[model samples]
Structures are given as C-alpha cells and as structure tokens.
Target: MDTILWIIAAIFVIAGVVTIVRGGLIYGIVLIVVGLLIGPGGVSVFS
Candidate 1:
C-alpha cells in the first residue's frame, strides 16, 4: 500500500516538475495537489 502510494506520488511529482518547467503553473499545482492527496501521509489516508 505504501509502495503504491509512493510510486504514484513520484509520478505526480515528476509530472508536476515537468509542467512547471513547461510554464504550466496551474497544471503543476493541480498535479502537486493530487500528488499530495495520493501520498501515503495525506489527510485522506491519515483519516
């Protein structure tokens, strides 16, 4: 479970970085938010 979350987080982080570098701040923010949500230590997961 943790591993899966980590993988998803990693992918999102990478995507967010790419989007940011590509000047897509909105998309990067969205991806980062989604990544945080998908992370193992996120609020939803904690609750």
Candidate 2:
C-alpha cells in the first residue's frame, strides 16, 4: 500500500512536470504540491 502511494505520487509529480511544460502553471503547481503531500515524507503530517 505504501509502495502504491509512492508510485502514485511519482506519477503525479511527473504529470505536474508535463503540465508546467505545457503552460498549465497553476495546475502543475497544484499537482506537485499534492504529490508532495501524499508522498512518504509528507505522511508524517497526517500521522
């Protein structure tokens, strides 16, 4: 389950990068932030 979340976070980060490159700055930023907050390190906050 943890590994799955990590993988999802990676995908979100990657998608965020693509969004930024495609001129969706706001969306990209949101995606990246959400990705970070969902990643392992960020779990401490919720935990």
Candidate 3:
C-alpha cells in the first residue's frame, strides 16, 4: 500500500511538473498538492 501510494504520488508530481512546464500553473499546483496529500510520507489520504 505504501509502495503503491509512493508510485501514485510520484506520477502525480511528475505530471504536475510537466503541466507547469507546459504553462498550467493552477492545475500543476493542485496536482502537486494532491500528490503530497496522497503520499504515504505525507498526509496519506488513503491511510
């Protein structure tokens, strides 16, 4: 479960970075925030 959360968080963060690079500021920030919240090391919404 932790591993899965980590992978999902990583993907979200990476996608957020890519979105920011592509000129999406708000969406990217939201994605990053959500990623952090869902991460096992962070808030872990699932846990």
Candidate that scores best on TM-score: 3
Stretches > 4 Å off in candidate 2: 44-46
Superposed on all Cα atoms, the candidates' RMSDs to the truth, in angstroms, are 1.8, 1.7, 0.6
**Model 1 TM-score relative to the real fold:** 0.80
TM-score of every candidate relative to the true structure: 0.80, 0.84, 0.94
lDDT of candidate model 3 versus the reference = 0.93
> What are the runs in model 1 whose C-alpha is more than 4 Å off?
45-47
TM-score for candidate 3: 0.94
The candidate, 1 or 3, that scores higher on TM-score is 3
lDDT (tens digit, per residue) of candidate 3 on 1-47: 79989999999999999999999999999999999999999998887
lDDT per prediction? 0.85, 0.84, 0.93
For the record, the alpha-carbon RMSD of candidate 3 to the native fold, in angstroms, is 0.6
Candidate 3 has which clashing residue pairs, if any? none
Error of 1 at 33 (Å): 0.8
